[model samples]
Target: MSEKNQRAHDLRMYFTGFGLAVTLTALSFLTAILQPFGPVGLFATLAVLAIAQVVVHFRFFLHIDLSRQAREDLQLILFTGLLIAIMVAGTIWILGDLMTRMM
Candidate 1:
């Protein structure tokens, strides 16, 4: 494709990603406020939307696809996510332990 066409294609991808992110955010907030699904249901809905938003951000904004070239980037992202999860879990565990001791 020509440079012009490529640019347009890239622009479209960015716009699409932006739209999806915005929609997901709005839905999450709305779910929280409306609580149509009750507390537990709202939590599940928000979790799903959050995951979808992550995917859209990676695929569109980050330009990371399933292509061979994107594999390394994808792996890096997954590793980072794993590290974050571990840290969060450790923090929660420590906090819980502290709270129990206090009680």
Candidate 2:
């Protein structure tokens, strides 16, 4: 495609991503305020929305994809996610243990 077309395509993708992100966020907040679901269902709904938001960010904002060219980027993101999960879990575990000891 021509340079102009490519730029337009990129801009469209960005706007689409932004719209999806905003929609997902709005849905999350609406769900929280409306309480349409029970406690467990509400948590599940929020979780799904959060995951979809991540996907939009990866696809549009970060331009990460499943193509061979994007494999390295995908790996880097997965590794970072893993590290973050580990750190969060470890912190939670330590806090839980401390709380239990105090009780």
lDDT (CA) per prediction: 0.94, 0.97
As a whole number from 0 to 100, the lDDT of residue 28 in candidate 1 is: 95
Query: Against the hidden reference, what TM-scores do the models get?
Result: 0.87, 0.86
Candidate 2 residues 77-97, lDDT tens each?
A: 999999999999999999999
Q: Which digits, one per residue and each the tens of the lDDT, describe model 1 over residues 7-95?
A: 99989999999999999999999999888998889889998999999999989998898899989988999999999999999999999
Q: Count the backbone clashes (under 3 Å) in each candidate.
A: 0, 0
Give the local distance difference test score of model 2.
0.97
**Candidate 2 residue pairs in clash (backbone atoms < 3 Å):** none
Model 1 ranges off by over 4 Å: none
Lowest lDDT 10-residue stretch of candidate 2: 72-81
